[model samples]
Target: MRAFFWAAWLGLCSTPLLAAPPQGFSFAQKDWELACDNTGACRAAGYGVRRGEVSVLLTRNAGSEQHLTATVTFAQIEHDIPADSTASLLIDDRDFGALDALDESHFRLDSDQTTALLQALTNQRKIEFTLNGQHLPLSSAGSREVLGKMDAFQRRTGTADALLDKGDAGDDAILPATPAPEIIAAPVLHNAQPVPLSMLQRQKLLPILTPLLNQRCDDWQNQAIPAADRQITLTALDKTHSLAQALCWRAPYNDGYALWLVDNAQLSKPRLLTTEASSYADGAIVFLHKERGMADCITGETRVWDGKTFTPSLKYSTGMCREITPGGTWMLPTFVSQVIPRQQKEADNLALRTLYNAVLKAQKSDPELSLNKVAEQFPLTGHITDFTLTYADDTLITTSKPSPDISDDEWQAFLRSSISADSENGKVSFTLIDLDGDGKRDLIIDSYVGGTGLFSYTGVLKRGDDDFAAVNGSDSDNGDDFDAGVPGALFSINGRGANQWNHWVKINGQVYALWYNGQFGEDNLYLLRPFSTTSQTPAVTVRYRYTLNSIRSPEKDQPLTPSLSDGDKADLLRSLEVMQGSLLKDRPASDNDAPICPIPPGTSADEADNYYSGVAVNYIYETVAYIPVWLNGKCYIGTIFSHHGAYRHGVDAEITLSSPREDEEVIGDYLISGLRHVIAITSGWKTREGDNGMQ
Candidate 1:
């Protein structure tokens, strides 16, 4: 690519003059061209080029402390112009009313009393200027000279010293020195080795030469040459030639000797197309065809002679052939085996059906064994080329290309193995016996190896006493001697026989051992004993059930009376006082670590003031033991001292015990009514005492 450069002149102005009338300033062309402003605080200078587009602007502060400004006279190349351009500054935030533009190739911003000018010049691409009235020339030649001088100075003083000095000398102006030219070495090109034509070898040999024979034959029809020349050509075409000679000498073959092609251009050794046996067999009729001037095709007879008479048994045809044995004899039947229609057809159908059944059974049995068994039983024999099996209801049918015979054993083995349970831990086992005492035998199976353990299924058959016997048990250790300890046990119960039961022995233990029993309503387990103790009865444990009401009384008991002695009474009263003070009204408290009386603020002297009052009556009887009783339901138990006098007077004598008060009704409804009254009495006494100064 291309390289581009950009430069911008931003103007910032001090507060505009607002005093007396300001003097005007003008800029001469020479001053504009030579002067450069370094402060960067210069007023806006218009007449800068931007991609060959130009603009002029006048700036004035609009209002406010931020010094908002508006453009008064703005002129610039329209947006999207396809050239270098310059913008004329109209409104800058700091300047109140100013005009800025480029004049004489210099940036100039003019105001009433202040005129700022930037003496800068630019070529077609970029502008170059120096700060503080320092002029910088604007030519490639000037840049090269400056660079050369600077480079020479750097060589004289070293780069570090030159950079430190930077062509700056006090009281004297300094300019950058020019740089020296640089030289680059030319690139070298190497001669590459010629690439071998290996990729084109096959294409040139095979594709090109095969068609050349016919093309050359057609070329013979061209009669433009003289008759003598044609005869010479015909004579030359009748000679014996090798591929190498044909390409080198361009000669055709003779009818006597076999033609051999050779590719001498390739590094490989030359090859012969016709062996001596082939030459003898075909009587020298061999030809080598090569395309694109390379050897490819070799044509000769297959039979070879053993230095004697030529063999004539070689044959060539495009069809499939298979050798029956290692002696290289093709498998082709010379005689067909005769078949009786009825028997052969029946056997074929049976074989096909067996295969179909085997495949269908594989879906439910061990898939691998099912498939192999099918192949073993109904093997593809005779002239079968393809076969298919399908299902119809519970039966399986098969269609064969050319069906064959299947023996009875093969069919039976296929059915048996297909439905047989898979071996467990390399062993096949199952058990049957009555396990639930429901008369029907339960079947237990162990189909997989490594102790698939045992699984039991209840049988549908029933026996006497509604008992069900386990019909099968395998690899099970269910804690019963006859049923549990038996491994691969298959039992059958004879309801009519004298022995009544017969089971196959699978485990190594005694055959008469009772692994489990269905005699009881459920499975009865028995531990295995030695043969000597097999006749002894086994120990057993029984379980029972009960209900909750039989363990506790049903009715609630009456509360206990106050039975404290004089000393205990005093202690109790003091304790009650402390409890009342701490107990707050409407706020319940736990009896565990209950607050002492002398009730806190926001509390009451009623039952509501006592926290432990609402606890269960039985719980209170267990914890406190005191109860308040009423004689006539009014002012009797827990009565205030003033009410105590009325209780001592005629009211106590006349009141009957049968009457109940409204507050008594409320207290009776709660489970802890007795404790609630005691707490209320204590709290009431404290309230009265606090009022009487006894508190």
Candidate 2:
């Protein structure tokens, strides 16, 4: 890949730098190579203890639209570590909870976390990532300079990504104010409603019509009839009644026509329910098919048409979601009965739910399941790593890294005597983790027996005064009942290996069981918040659903911080203007002053400000790539507070900038309604690393 990238760069350099800047730039910073591509894509990549192995990578996307990412990649592992397992990062002895895992080797921090990490990487003398039982030290040598170079490259590419404070000069973001509530998306409704033909014809409905047209035939490649003769019908579908009436035979866009619907009472001018690929029912469920790679990503909305207005349902879907409602029918593996049968993979939630439930049951029933077994079957599948053992203070006791001195017999003895006294006829696998938030390290053990059933004994070994003891749980001892592990289907199949239950997750002040529904790469987090009780029968909220992007949606948006007074808002905005000076160009201001923090689509900046007040709200990494539609062929720099369009008004999209305002010039908060005005796209406010020197 390096050879190919270099070759591409060498070829691009033949051109002049007049129309565009230099195609590429490469320089060495600290022990890292800071490289930038023609489009301003830059990366500060370096190694840890081992060379040639990527350990830390900081990327700043300075293209048309800006995106910044930070990654810490771990070394190789021999055993499987659950991706959901908690891995702690110690920056000069202070513990920052497990970094978000992009994979077992690579972990990506969020914008806030990345900001904190960049600071630590630049200032702290020591940094260590503790996963399973392994203690991986990351050298901070030259990291500060590397980050500086990263900022320089970003500026050259027009990103100006991060304004990292000099040395430990700014306030610590280690515990920045509790983050603001994520803007939760409205509940998305997919059920389609029928509407009258008159409404559809008068409104020129396409959102409803396209699907029915698609259902009528496969594609428009071989339509036999022309526009005039095609039969167009309209259906009135409601909870109470449903009927269809034939409409005039006409098809727009030179295509055939089909039955369609429109919400006549939903909007000011009878909005086209079918026009936006929306499912009409109460109001309209609008969606768009965003193509990401070969997979089709669905982002959409659920809005209810009240008598007067179209209200957002606040439930929506974001990220790359497969049409689990299969387009065509096929056979799928089934665990409904003891005998494995092939069932039709129908296009409905029932089939998918049934399959998931079966997998869960099988995981519960499979006693001999082992993490090692699953690892062998599905290599590189989960956030998996080698088994690790650490001391009480998270110091490394032993790891799965192969030693040069140990023979096979000696290694076997080491495995047996590491933590447990005896294997007791099962494979010995253990990890150092902290279940009850004490400073001491706890043990997670999987003592496996033979058979694809519940022969495996797995549970936590809470640290005691002398050694570790079995946790006071029903499945602590060799028992029939225990969550065999996540991905129960795999557990049922490989019962004789290891248990891959993930580590615990603490939200607010409570710890809960966290797991993933889908396989690796495709992530769907299930945060099961457990209600504390002494009784063995547990009560949990069952699940909290989200993809990484949808973590902060409108419905889920909460004020994780205190509210700021108008005075505080005014003062902070003034201070922030100083930082925006670095990114703003010399341009005339419009007659109207930019609103303090305008929240478009009916919400004001003040409402949003109150909604997301305090230090947390001020530091939101909401940057956007906006084209300054210049008046008379000139560009002006300003901030873009919030965008309200795509998939029902700024639903699950992200907008973050590195340096929004600098030099006493604030980026105007103009909600650009049309695209014709935009000329150059760049970052807005809510800059990265440190928010206007406020950390």
Candidate 3:
């Protein structure tokens, strides 16, 4: 979940400080810091940054009936507090009562004490603790901002359970808690030995890994390692794969090692999992890092191998650095998962089957077969992780496999490609997978069905002797009640609405479809079973229904429009031309492939680089081209375009501009200002007047 959120954040926050608050984030103001993890739980910590003072930690779990908890620990910079010392809480110079000792220097506040402390923090009253005849005052410089962010993150600003803004609204609408996902670790091959890279192997593999190391590892690129220190070790993961480890960086307190998954036969490229890992053993990697030099607070992460890849199994952070306890005060986990051993998985599955059958019996339904057995019997193969689309003779083609010899841009524009199901001018996407029992791969194309409203039409094409062909016969004899058929099929699963969208997730070689109706609505999970032939359409069963209402819509603060001067507009046009030229330069040699940028009117072939050479005012008919953009595990096919300008029929690639400099670059400043308005309008809050481009 964190990985998905990170990718989305990268796409949205291309520029620093110009992005909105992400789904989950760590925000800090002054000495106070509020960290809202991926699971929606929030932890706010406050202490003096310059001096050792009293520190407090406030924690609130997601969902209703979850109350806020407060804990405090005395800051000991140079000396430790006496074990027998008594402590008392004071608010505005008024002593409430003796503090309950949680440890030698840490204290837990009672309900009444916590309430008074909250009031004091909100009212700017002094909060202090008297321990061993010493007064430790807690700073309140950034408490309000940090607390407000927490309330906003939990969607409790207007609810009765809100800590900052009390209102009449009920707390029932507050975001619900999401259970952490579970990962079962595969057994490690303890008998396998680590193989040091030989000189010949190093010479063969250094070119392939050097670029990745230079980008992801600090020690390899920034600091020169001695001949004795430089080393690479590979440990066998399975018959085909191995784990490669190398030193990443070194600090005063800890050293980080980079971990990568490499194919033993060098059949595929290496994949870097992390660069801050500590150790790897028993099919798991542990990461430990100190937050401060005092070693009072630390953060830890663990990733477990689940056969296919390294899965994030645990993530936690100890409370603020108060020196009350070594390795921090409390174990505050933002991400956690149950790890089951390989031997116990079968037993776990049996228990789960019994529970599922019990639920089905309660509903008067027949006991269904074990989903695990179904997954194993019909495991999906040739699952394409990603693909690029190009055109051949005005028809869209799917390029799932690319050659390593070609550059990224050139590989994106393929030479010979499989024709898509539709040629209509709309966003087209396809994936390659073994749909039938045949070992040959098949194609599943998603295209826009022609209509006044937006609709997605999915169809399957089976592999033939030479190329992919439509399903041979009608799927009406499949004995399923779904609105599915051969060749051109609607959504494959049952109970799916017209507004719903689907994305496939592969876990342990089995493919499952997560179908959702809206941005914040119920999700239908479906498992696609393999079929013997094209005529025998794969059966779909709804495995579970997940109600997703926790993710809320962001509040819009301004409109989407840029205030650009004539000079700024000219600079933007020039910048766009340069970007378009670069794309054309690296484009593969394909005359029929669709080009993102078209040749402008009256532009010669030799002068294609200057397509936007005319005066900026002349093209004041600047049209906003809407293209299909994939973000956050969903594809948004844009249909809205400005009516004021002529619509250009081609892909409008997203442009990333550099930071603005007063003396040199004005495109970044003006373009970003315009983007701010555009972002606000498209945020789904309210549309700007006379702007019909938002959906």
Candidate 4:
């Protein structure tokens, strides 16, 4: 395989950039495939069984007024066809008419011809073309299924604009064509600076790039390549930034270039963009891979420099190797973007990544490092003033200073407004975003409440009179569960991953937070009215519940089973025994420090075995477990938060009720003052347990 000139196959780039980008869907079956882009434009391509065969492309934009367009191209031939050469369109051996030549190998079908072709494909009739005294057959095998998906994705299946099952149904429900995401590209440098990297500069970058090189470029360790040849080529991206490129690896068809965005000053920090890049030119990292040895089909990608980092601009693929033209048949892109040229000054905004790196760097050595101290150590660029740091255990803003950005009255008001904290007991990180599209930014505080599950909470605080008010319905008198400071409005996700689960979208001019309710059997999409409230407090409604019928039969009432390691069981039972010895009819306040739910003495693991049962909230996956402990010769129900990794947190058994406290009420709040003592002592046990952690 060899590098093919993309400009030579310019005729194939006829796909138009349309206007509301969808999530984009693509499906393939047999010899046919369909692709719908973010703009809702759909393109279906079908071909013969093998490569170097004739193929057809069917395209239709998203809007209701859009019509289907058809084009056909012949297989590779030694002799070039004349520009005036035409191909006769045939449906089941019926010659509809001749198609005008698009170029040497491609032909364009008029609207009537396109309609006839669509009908033949949907009806499973034979489709062929007569060109140069030979018949070029097109398979209609998977055309119906692929085209049907296209119509369904665009919501045109029942509309007049649909290619399949066209009806008189109104086209009002059809998806509109959305514009491709626009990227602001910084001015491209014509040439690199004359000077090569000095020994000192190389030394600084060696540690930072060595790990990446070891992982991506196996050739770096091979003795065949000279040591001098394996160096990175650095080009000035801007005054403070540079682009670093090193050959990552070599493939049969192409060479991979590992690209990194480097900060000229901070050689310790570098971001890896891509390792499969081919070259960097015109402010974009270009990637091209030949699909086969013939170089007839290719896959290409372009990531444009967007001042801060490389942003994906285009992802292109030529439809199957009809071998019609050297660079494949037609342009079929999975992703597309509009690159708007901008001057360096115009694109020189402070990158959020820089701020994130600063924050992470400070916490690298000390995870407990406060964000306020981080800002003090490394002052961030932009017009930000003052800092408020909130910790995991902190109920209020622990440390805050007056801001120059707001007035004395406004600053005080802002300080008075606190985030609606969660009970998951995790540290919070705060950021600002215009969630409501009102131009005024809102505060988003994210926290990872550690347990078995890496459950997180994202609280929104919209700007109020002069401060921020919690969007978790703090002011509501609705007598909901949130009133007791319980965690509410949980981010609709489990585990620590991308912090974008709360997707805020605009519908009919109102911004609503859209999220998926991942219940056991109810996977639903819910829209939250961020500002809508009955009592001036925005509340998230809990519409889904985890009932007995959700996972088990309603008739059976099972006892909690003891699921604990021997060491954990001994420690917890001993703690409970200590509390049992201190129990009194009128328990003294000093006994609050005594551990509760400890197992009674002289009871064997079998005879005095603790029974445990676990339950998880269907939506958030937050789990709770209850265990029956023999305390003071009576069974006391003990409850604890349970999950996959809860054992690592040591034992935190809390007495939820006395023996008669059966049913599901044991999972709820119960009088357990002694449990407070268990919480105080569990930290020491967790620290000492090491590998034999408890729960």
User: 294-409 in candidate 3: lDDT tens per residue?
Assistant: 77778888889888898887676765665645566545555555465564454334433433343344324322222233233333346353343555554545444443533343
Q: Tens digits of per-residue lDDT for model 1 on 126-206?
A: 332222222222222232222233223223223222312234332111221111111111111122221222444434443
lDDT of 2: 0.34
Top candidate by TM-score:
4
lDDT of 1: 0.23
Candidate number with the higher TM-score (2 or 3): 3
Model 2 agreement with the true structure over 86-105: per-residue lDDT tens digits: 56566777777667653344
Backbone clash tally (model 4): 17
User: Could you tell me the TM-score of candidate 3?
Assistant: 0.44
Best by lDDT: 4
Task: Output the better candidate (2/3) by lDDT.
Answer: 3
lDDT of 4 at 28: 82
Model 2: what TM-score?
0.25
Candidate order by TM-score, decreasing, is: 4, 3, 2, 1
- C-alpha RMSD of candidate 1: 47.2
Using all chains and alpha carbons, the TM-scores for the candidates as numbered come to 0.10, 0.25, 0.44, 0.46
Arranged by lDDT with the best first, the candidates are 4, 3, 2, 1
lDDT measured at residue 22 in model 4 versus the true structure, 0 to 100: 74
Q: What C-alpha lDDT do the candidate models reach, one value each?
A: 0.23, 0.34, 0.51, 0.54
Which stretches of model 4 miss by more than 4 angstroms? 1-20, 77-83, 191-196, 224-229, 344-695
